[model samples]
Target: MSEWRIYRGVREPHDGIDRLPDPPPWRDFELSGEVTPFDRHADALGDRRLPRADAYKAEERTIEAVNTALYLRRPLLVTGDPGVGKSTLAYAVARELKLGAVLRWSINSKTALRDGLYQYDSLGRLEDAGVARELRGPTNGGPQVGERGDVVAEDVAAAPASEEAHSTDLGRYLRLGPLGTALAPYALPRVLLIDEIDKSDIDLPNDLLDVFEEGMFEIPELSRVADKQSEVRVRPADHGARITVVHGTVRCHTFPFVVLTSNGEREFPPAFLRRCVRLHLPAVDDDERLRTIVRAHLPTAAEDADEVISKFLSHAASGELATDQLLNAVYLVSRTARDGAPSLDRLTALVFQHLNVTVPTES
Candidate 1:
């Protein structure tokens, strides 16, 4: 895939945001193995997937919050209603940071730290082992091909193959869930987005607080085995490998680009909020919202853009429609237009149908 594009048009507004001082050469980062730290890569920090200025509605406040988090090296808490792009902020940060990977831990009632970081897929591993055994065993040399495939009794006795594959600490193969994938070592810093923290149970957030605070976790799978002290396999994010926990515990080897989002539907513990730099995203207005949809989904300027946008704006103004549904309507209308131009009536009908609002009748 092509490298992610960062639009210059979006970044021109924040032309004067002061950048942090360059780090010393001694602070360089090495993801696969420890290396000398250096400031040479400092300039590359904060290069994320989304342009810093793309968030046009809350340009100043958003940039300030992001810059603050970068400078303070703290977690940013983005709280807002759904579809307001709260989680997208993390993507913006990842783009700015120039980080190749972002660890996303989507929080829900069933979520746990273990679920986010790494959970071994036993089924996949078992399937792999079974296939390996079938491939490696016997090349049909049984009893000289059993005299033209007639005498199978002696062929069966040639070798008693074991059906059971050696059991692997299957969990050791714990594929880094989105969380673990983010933490996987990389030449660039990784963005770790813990989305919808409010959907999680009380204990889930509390559990994550510890890991984020410490900046690491133990991959008992990656640790030094008692017998294999010299053998250590550290998997890079691009490659799939399980971490083994050795002496002490596996801690966050590198501080991740962490962004935790919430819909603000539930309140978090004070201590939870204390560690994070919280930013509440207010609702975007009609004009700003329309512009956002235009920029995000209709970059080519579909002919029906204005009409679709106006309908959605009216719906939003009357509190009868959701921002996403509005965007979806525009998307479908634009996609179905025979020549990239939808008629006003068609656009209006789609809006009314999707938004579930009845049009007023003329008396």
Candidate 2:
């Protein structure tokens, strides 16, 4: 709800620390739409159900890698097991930097590089064209030019010719995907979350190399008409936000702060790995993580949080839980218990239970 602040108290000394650019080198950007700071709308940065954005407990190494990526203009490749706070890192950076809402591109087995760049609604455009043509004038039922009918040539020419129809404008039907939107020539670099990229097809990671290197891409659909038109307004990834591009190409003014997260489901190519600033996220130190979750969410249950966190850690030892599970357990204890009662063993067992682990039956 408030402006997010990153805790730099646990700062780590990184290579080339003294040489880091002030305000980053890539600050000269062209604004495509309204420029708003993240603090102005911090509530929309992440899922409201989970208040994890403000409580991102970053260690020295991650912050260093993030800075290195920013300075070098390389994507930050964050690898970790499920729920180790890999995806959350992007939101954290965007919130800290006052970058607008993070553009998220979720990956799956069928995902490809283009899936993140743009989505062309060819069918929708065609359907809309048919409707627009009819609205302009009756397609078949119109009488001869001299004959009086529901639609007349003069009326059609005078009324519709002056108006621009979305169907006729190919750019109108175009929607920039999260990646493409982030690449728009905005004054501030957008935070892009390439979530769970390892789940994508093998070629997906390789396919992004060219676009990443070039820092721009062309919309072939719009390019076809670019010879006659210099500028075209198209929809960006953000709802209701449109960007105008010269010659139908979207180039990044400031290379996007790309945070690519992988759950270690698959290995990337050597070439891809070389271009990225890799960060492996291990499970956070228990005491710190516990304190973070408790302090941010359940301050009332402070006295009993350590005991609850210990139970959660014991359950997580079997490799079937996530950090959020501990949060859930702690939040529940904070709510269900009024007085700091340590007699929540049964509740902890229920909350922290992993489905894969066989629970002993009553004898």
Best by TM-score, which number?
Answer: 2
lDDT of 2: 0.69
Measured against the true structure, the TM-scores of the candidates, in listed sequence, are: 0.64, 0.78
* 156-232 per-residue lDDT for model 2 (tens digits): 23226533344346676678999998888765567899998888888888899988877888887667567756678
Candidate 1 Cα outliers beyond 4 Å, as residue runs = 1-58, 121-172, 184-188, 221-227, 234-248, 320-322, 332-363
Runs with alpha carbons beyond 4 Å of true place in candidate 2? 1-50, 135-159, 163-167, 338-343, 354-363
lDDT tens per residue, model 1, 162-182: 422122233334455666555
Worst 10 residues of 1 by lDDT: 1-10
- What is each predicted model's overall lDDT from 0 to 1? 0.54, 0.69
Q: What is the lDDT for 349 in model 1?
A: 60
